[model samples]
Target chain A: MNGLNGIGVKVVHVGGNGNAHAVLREIEARLQLLVEKGEEGSIDLSGLPLMPEDYDLLEETLGEGEVVAEVHSLGPTRIHETGIPGVWWVTHYNSDDEVLAEFIEVAWCPEILLTPEDDVKDGLEALRARLFELNPKSPLGGAPSLDL
Target chain B: MRDETLLDTLKRRGISRRGFLKFCATTASMLALPPAMAAEVAAALGKVRRPAVIWLSFQECTGCTESLTRAHSPSIESLIFDAISLDYHHTLQAASGHAAEEAREHSMKQDWGNYLLLVDGSIPLKDDGVYSTIAGISNLQMLKDAAAGAAAIVSVGTCAAYGGLPHANPNPTGAVSVSEIIKDKPIINVPGCPPIPAVLTGVLAHYLTFGAIPDLDDLGRPKAFFGESIHDRCYRRPFYDQGKFAKTFDDEGARNGWCLFELGCKGPTTHNACATTKWNGGTSWPVQSGHGCLGCSEPDFWDGGSFYKALSTPISPVTGAAAAAVAIGAAAGVAIGLANRQTKAAAKAAHQKATIADLEK
Candidate 1:
């Protein structure tokens, strides 16, 4: 049993069609392209006709890396780097913790991890509002010093 | 009657930009579109208002509705329902009697020529269509009335698409498909005993994203889901190619996961996304569970033949002929080789005699 977004999921292993090697070859090619062109690329793992065994094979071969994260949005999105430096595994799950999409991205960082410009702008305004509410009139012309 | 756009609704529900993006990517993948198209889908879906949808059920077993509702919550498939204002459905609606009929009429009058019409099960035509009736209105009359104002009609199951089980052998009520009755509006046929939930949602997503129906095959099915035969995309195809087959349910081949073609697997001719998209949220489909395909998506599958009988001939007759030709060609090559050897041996003997005579001279 594996827990995703607080939901217990039973993972069942099944047979494959021997396409895991082909997918590995594709990843290698994509990695090479990333190296030569300095361009990012990704493969939609959910779109492929891969079985549980194929997924297991890919996971075993890729192993694990240092970085791992969980982004809570609609539900939860898990993103982790594989053993390879540039390869990342990203999975998006719905509120029920069912996998909505999965991808193998070859890039410095997956796109979903980046904070949107609008979000940053909103965050700045929110922080300013909260600070003003905390100290409407403080020393140094309404700006409180960190030493306080 | 929510006035907010889809994006607004998602935002109100606390879904972030990343979540929406993820939903769009999943939608694109479900529709078999490239990942890049997810942006386009997002742009279109974000601003689009919910379209009014009217679901009409006739001679059906409620299987299609059951199949659709089985889609996991908060999933993209379920989100499609949130994207649409479902005005009327006998099974899912809260209203009934005249009130139920009133909602259907109001939706037609309010969103006439724009509302999407979804029909399941066949419509009986014989005997003045008295076999089935909703709110005292006959199935035939109700279909014609509803179809008149619908922008387009989606025949959800094999029944509404190809006159399914109700129109099987004997076809007591002389039932016919929606296309046989409604001619003006464009109809998308999603034929299956009960279609995959994602397929119906994919069609809806394509329509919602592009404001037009997706590319369809000759049978009016979305080509994205019906383009490839199950056998062609099946994991057991290699077994079929190697002539490995499962003869009985308990046979060694069956236990070893061999091809089910000899066991009346209709995957070779039946086209659907089951082999890839799979059923029960990518868990398993019939073939994966060690059962032969029933060819449920094809037209007239009920009367096609026995489910247990093997296909009369190989999927492609030419394949059998080619195998026979290869064998005959191999035999002919051996015979020609023997003849060539004999000729070479005789020529060598004659050359020896000639050389001896020359030496004597």
Candidate 2:
């Protein structure tokens, strides 16, 4: 690919009607640990909105890359059980670190007063800093940091 | 009248002097020659006596003529009548039946070993050349006879250049290219479904000015225009290089104006001036209009697979894990994510607009 950094990343989106609840539950259920869900004001989940408020938010809230939106799959078999509509949000993070770490705080929820546009311009940048701290080797995984 | 200059013959035939000059200039520019060369063109074309052009139509439609006549930029009239002496053309000639045959013969005899052989279609050797005929004479016989005394042969279409559509799959006519028949004479293959009129005129202008054919490719096509593939000049090639492709006509990729390779574009394999020269007064080529290249200028393009399939090898990561790894870490991952999202949103918006309009109605 042209101008590629050669570092591949996957945007894994996990969503449901109550994404915060679901993510919290998954972390708890899988690792058997409790997470102090941050207060609504302290956390910025505007970039992860489940619904479209504007063109920018709508763009960020849907698709497999960085954001994901839930839509009916309409697959051939077992359509009823797996066909239910759900919220989806995508984020580019190292999967190996995510798989290795026992617990971590992530703010991908669009609801809880988070808009696509946030008051903190560098809030995502700080969140990235915290994410890297939790797993020191996350950024050193030989993946090209194609971050613009 | 017999001793009239070429310009005087054109004037007697009702072609304007200004039209003749315009044709000369356009020819010069098309050939990428210096503007000063136009004077050389006008001088050479003005002094020569009526040069004989024996045009043989073989196994193909008259699209080449239609395109030729529709050359309003320089105007085909200026090229055919003002520039050279078009002695025999089946479509344009007034005489028919025995008189038409006689006209070709008389012109051949009149300008022996000097006339130009302009072939617009391919010849079928199958069943004794029964695929196409004129006045009870096979195209093969007429072409051979016309070519016998001709100085050079100009194959004007893909049919004549590379056995175009008639030579496609299960070809019942056993169509053969003009190169196969007239090997001795200098053959210039202008291979397009109907090549750009400017290209045709350019070749003629170069020949008329220099008294020799321009440099030709291995395929006998003039190297000036057919040297580069359409893909090399396509504006959308950036999108292809970035790994962006329009998956379907109505998809987000299409709405985002992504690469059309996934949709079967033959731009990579097909060489032509369409990308640079453009069509209909240099407005846009087919890809700009949301259609992929069908590779019309290449040999046997008609028999090629679906027009939307990309001609080159796939360049994306081979394995899913590899693709996912690249997708997850690289900023390209962000771009890929953004591209997918943007495409989807655009599609959704279009769908919404259509639905709302329908509901309003």
Candidate 3:
């Protein structure tokens, strides 16, 4: 019990616009209750008890590149339901730094998984076969159109 | 001799053809070239006649020469000088006095605008270049004379590149690099205390095969060797990023092989491939062997700072020990009280033992 310090991860968010104080306050209130109950170790913001409107409040305050959240995983807490094995909480904010965009990317992990040599060959073959069935100059003939 | 192949020359010198090929492979790897390039290097080297090279030594300790000749792996003398037609070297040439000078003169004249110039030290430019003399001529005049008809120049050590030890603070003789004086010819700087022998041979091989100097950086150094900073390729860089530093030589940190960032290692700022290429065939670099890099290759690295101080941290105590002692005693009274009691009992026992011995005498 002497060194039961929780591990907290600080994430510096960049990009997006708006004030972050209100979103921060709401997160603090929710986290404070969890801390009091000794359940503050691993938080699932994706499963947060708060309303979707409240989550929207957070989204509204965030600008791109802003630090929208900090995750704190209490030493003893276990997060069984969220599928992630670790216990952590995220505190969010908004900022304007650019390098974090790679980390912020929506399709980052999927891109990493699909960009390997075998995957690239599979993709190229699919594209090549699709080309025979379509008109060369038509926008939607070879592949899905940009609008869709 | 004129028509001898490189393999035949090596065999004549008792170095096996396979061993000579291994040397070429080692050279290609050292230059960071692909493995496929090794056979091309060997083939190219075998066909060409040895290019004429003239060695010159100026204001130096001849450590470069010592390092070059002492290279036991490939033996710099055999791989470098013998591979090339070293027509005139002051230390190695048989001729003496005016005759030696005359040989150097003849080589430059006969191979005019074709011979390669290898300078081992800096040229003193102050006081009409009277500081360093060779054959009754200042280094400046000799440099001007040699560089006049040379095809290319390779400044062989730190002295020839950044004006080594002689150019430290209060450099009285105004020791300047070869480029500072000889600006006409294409110069390639190979800077180190005594640069790695493989790097030296690699550059020479590149020049021989291509018939022109290799790609150079802004400093006139080859990009293949000097492209990245030492920190970028250092094995201990992960430890540095994690902020795990060795504070002392014999401490637990040092024993764990932690990053030497706290020990004034200039690997972060200095650019060289020593961390990867290493000395004596990838055995170890200075930081790997427990000593920090002193940034020996950079200009004015000798006077930068102490080798053991952290590059960014504060070394001295923020507050005095007396103040810390009082504060610690006040804050942790029980711990201090127990320590003081143990000290007093130990001192009292020693004192009483001394007094009893005096009384008995």
Candidate 4:
């Protein structure tokens, strides 16, 4: 027997505390703002007191959309567009795969999806170095000019 | 780590701008700051150099240290702890004997009036404070010595914040809290049996982000964490409103996860972040695990009364108009009390400002 010693386990079902509806209302307002003014907004879901059933209700209400993105930085971040257009669900995790934060983002595109200018520059430099390594004889050879 | 700013360290560790922003946003939420303050936190945290911290353990158990260190690595608490330059901690430091004492003295001298001095457990005052000594140095003497040049002091546990168990009835050691002894420095009390890991780290983050202590309650606790009573935020509050309570350990109400107020829950009077922040990485708190709050965060809680005995305040079910009136009355009382405390705090702040201005002049 798996450590239970004959103790019975019971699972209790509890209903939502109406927190999901409140969150959905806030999301609606943020979505409206996103539409009218092209403004981006996010609610920190991790900070709120949402129960498991509340989370289920929210998921069921929002549904899911087409776009799904994963960002690997400090850890993996999952960004999914909800069924509602311009509404996104973002969950950040640490290296140990423990959730660090969760957000309900309302925007055309979440900020985390955009490539930073600095990283883009670094990527360009890396690409140039790779090209030089592939063909050393080429004029694009050593210490390629920053004009590119 | 000592020379580099937090931003530089994060960047060196391959954390991207987006990652850093996410961390900042998480920190803002953890600190209960407005979402708009995330940018401010980011700006401040990026520029903050790791400040030296000297953690001193005194006349009690090391539960506080364990509570802090038990958080899984790479978690927010651990990350914030990592960002600090921990110059001295007898429990965690590698040095021993004279070398350990030497490190403490060295950090104290080097950082002088700027380093953060963290203290867990109370200092014994009886018998020339001979009861508890580290390397032959009495806890009282060491505390006084370290506190002399420290910029601020953080009393880490209930023992160090209040007198705790040692200072309960029939006290032998004549133990006293850090505040009772050291009154000059700004002391932030993170009091619990062992404070929530996030609460301690959140205090540290607030200090690092703003270059000042977070706004504190009347008890010198960070108001962000201790602002609301656990009862007010408890999941079983609806049950309490409906007069459903667990009378015994194996009662049907207990099985149904009803209110534990009848079982002597101190959540009503006890202010803490546990109801919301939970424990063991948001897993469960004492109430969630079918136990009542022990009011461990409050002063003299050990001597307050039996933990199993319900509070003197009468709790009864009231509906409609009566419920609304009760709620309004409680709210008004709380508001008035808070107003009075705020006024007093403001006066104290003004007095300190004037004193500083005088010193400058």
Candidate 5:
């Protein structure tokens, strides 16, 4: 589940061991500081024990927005944009559907969501070749009629 | 009137200035004031005259008194009480009969129209208030008499504040709170079966510092302590929002420290500092000890049925859908199969035959 992006290098832990609101209080405090500083940061959740309930909290707290994109490398890595701009919910999993990593990335756009430049070059060539196939031969190259 | 200031007394008793400041800091935080106010509290408290406090008991158990008197590590609280000229407290005073009566009268006359009058139990007006008497004076009569010249009255327990157990169902004593009778005075309700030690003390500290009653809620309860419901401040609240609950005590959920909302925890409605301040001096409160809140702080809580019953079934719908969820779980899988070609192409472009040196990298 996507979590609320938190503050500067600070991991507000929502532990299952009865620290029910430690994270909520930390979030409240960080929100107060964010207003003063006019910047944001991500919540590091690598520490502490987590559970399904914790995932529900992440979903409820971060809040989902439109624009979901899935990437596949080792496994499916889904990226979701949250209601807040510059906030992203990223979850990477292995082929077995076992979660590898999950994080709330805070930025203009998470690096994982964008295609790398070298890969884009290949995409350009593939699109040109598709145009060549669409029209076996054309006086002015069929790419001129391409909507993209 | 004794002119020796609190600072003077504490210094004589070997309590350093730092010790007094630390106590003031704890007092400030407990009262929900900014930490910086501690110094101001210390400065104001150190200069003030040992204000006279007259404590009266009526129809109730002595649990409230026990909470304060039996407080562990009573040094700081004791010193503060010592700093105050507690002219009369029935349970703590060494005087008997006429002497106790005379001391009350004396303190009343000395600090007339200024002394703090603390009432701990509900006053019964039944049978011409003959049910409970102190010094042969009816509770109603004694209450009216004592309230006459007091600066303000503090209803120190649920009984004195909201006619606690004595006014519960059947209402045998026809008991009433101090506010029901004394309508003119400003009353501070520190209502709890037995209020937290620092809460009442915090109210006293506020009064001692500001010379006025702190902000109060509608029920005459102090806003600082009773401002938020126990559920909001509870440590197991995440479990509630996550729809996880412990159905019965000692179940797996209970052992996992899940929310006890299903176990009739009245924490959602009850307002008190027990969760934050904790009993046994920060050791644990009722919820921390593995039980739902009994809502003891609320008015007429004794009438609230069976403490083990859940507040409401907040998780029945989730449990009802578990079977359906298991069936549809496969169909709800992510549609990522078709998108794998681009990833495969990218991997093929990046792949290199493994060499022994690549393993190290």
Candidate 6:
């Protein structure tokens, strides 16, 4: 986040230090529940009415990880994997570039990244056509060679 | 030549004597049998003749058959499946046309009243069973005809047990459960969208061991498997007890893997072994995979209102009346307690002391 901050986005710590700590503590409790029971949940930051700076501070508190997924379908949605596995920081930006939504998602990964069964079923015909192309006897593809 | 026994079949299938014994031990434990009973079960199962089974499909999606075939690999459940003399199954049976019907007739006649009838689907009674037909014979007619010669029946899916999805709302087909149709024979309901495979084999094992239907609930489902609700055995139940629920699918609560009760989980009302036995070999269940239960095992689940509706939310007029009844009962309890207190106090006031002087007089 600090490296990306150099690209013109202003950075500052949130005004509500106590609030950030409390929310972090709440999240910590939820994480503990997950570790104990394998139970997961999402905490809506918008409901918390967290300031933009608060979101930044929360991310800083969570620290960073190696993997992140960017989704542009609904809006500019970015999911940042926290240091802890199964914990994620999801943020959404509006058309005007203002933060419209935020959530601390606790799961293996964000559900939005996964392809649904119905969608896959809808694409089956096209996928099957590709399958035909990869077939050995088909004109689009060739047979396997004797030497491996 | 003598008919091959279960032990013979297992050995033929390359399962060692030790492996076979281990399965018997596991089965004994799963069925809650005594530790010493494992040896008995092993001996009984080994020497027992393969019992004939006839599987009939009707108004079903063939999901039950799929669940059975796809149970955990190299498991004894599958071995029992292979060991059983499945004489006729519409889905899995290779024979077709009149040949298949002939095979079914032959088995029924040969086995007489000894073959186990494993039925998976509702018997449609509407329009003389015109909604569904096989080989020009109605499902109702076939069921009645087959049930006559069956020792016992195992209703394999929710459809056969409780007139599942097909019986939901309007119920155009006039679908009925196996119990509703055939009352004389002992019937065991293994209700689920598709019940866990081990549970299916578990019933088979019980039959093989004891030569009778397992102890059943009022609904005729085996008490061993259908004894508990999905909610009771669910891993997510702690969150439910804590009142933490996912209001939306993609919410923080959901991502955090809270209870799905708020998202319309039917686990509380639904009775099945999905939470414990699980699907895909105990890897995950509907709740664990982030979805609320559809309550597929229970009677008329589809008609119980929207699948996404929360349990706490009133789904019908009965819910409101029930809540009001609770309030009235509580008020009555308080009124009765007050009256009792007054009566006790009056009795205390009315009490007369019997003195030693009075006694002497």
- Can you tell me which runs of candidate 1 are displaced by over 4 Å? A1-15, A138-148, B1-3, B313-361
What RMSD does each model have against the real structure? 11.3, 34.4, 24.0, 16.9, 33.9, 18.0
Model 4: which docking level applies?
acceptable
lDDT over C-alpha atoms for residue B54 of model 3: 92
**Model 4 reaches what TM-score against the true structure?**
0.85
Residue range A1-148, candidate 2, lDDT tens digits: 1212264643222122233443334433423222344421111132111211222333333322433332111111010111111222222111111110011222334231132233253455666667677776775533333354
- In model 5, pairs of residues that clash are B264-B309, B264-B310
TM-score of the second chain, each candidate in turn, equals 0.85, 0.77, 0.79, 0.85, 0.83, 0.83
Cα lDDT tens digits for candidate 4, A1-148? 2233365756474566567888899999999988899888888875556777889999999999999999987678899999999999998877777776788989889888998787798898898799899887787666675874
Residue B34's lDDT within candidate 1 is 69
Provide fnat values for all models in the order shown: 0.41, 0.00, 0.00, 0.24, 0.00, 0.00
DockQ of each: 0.32, 0.00, 0.01, 0.28, 0.01, 0.01
The lDDT, on a scale of 0 to 1, for candidate 1 is 0.85
Residue A139 lDDT in model 2?
59
Q: Write the residue-wise lDDT of candidate 3 on B1-361 in tens digits.
A: 6455555566677753334544554455545665446567777766665678899999988888776774533442355556678878788779989999999998898888888999998888889989999989999999999999999999998889988888877889999989888878899998888887657776887876556788888878898887777777666676778788888887887876678887788887676667656664444568777788877777777667666776665445556987999888887998878899999998987774457769899
**Candidate 2's residue-wise lDDT over B1-361, tens digit each?**
4344555655665644434544454455566554446567778766655556788898889999887775534433353456477778889989888898898899899888988888988899999998788888898998888888999999999999999998998888999899988879999999898888767866776676566788998889888888888887676676789898899987887766677888888888888877756665443468766788888888888877656556664433358987787767787778889999999998988874357768888
Which stretches in model 3 have alpha-carbon errors above 4 Å?
Answer: A1-148, B1-24, B75-80, B313-361
Model 4 lDDT tens row, B101-159: 99999999998998899999999999999999999999999999999998899999899
Model 1 quality (TM-score): 0.85
Cα error, residue B60 of model 2, in Å, equals 0.7
TM-score per candidate, chains pooled: 0.85, 0.57, 0.58, 0.85, 0.63, 0.61
Model 5 chain A poorest ten-residue lDDT run: A1-10
* Residue B355 in model 4: lDDT: 72
Candidate 6: residue B204 lDDT (0-100): 88
Question: What i-RMS does every model get?
Answer: 2.0, 29.5, 25.3, 2.1, 21.0, 22.3
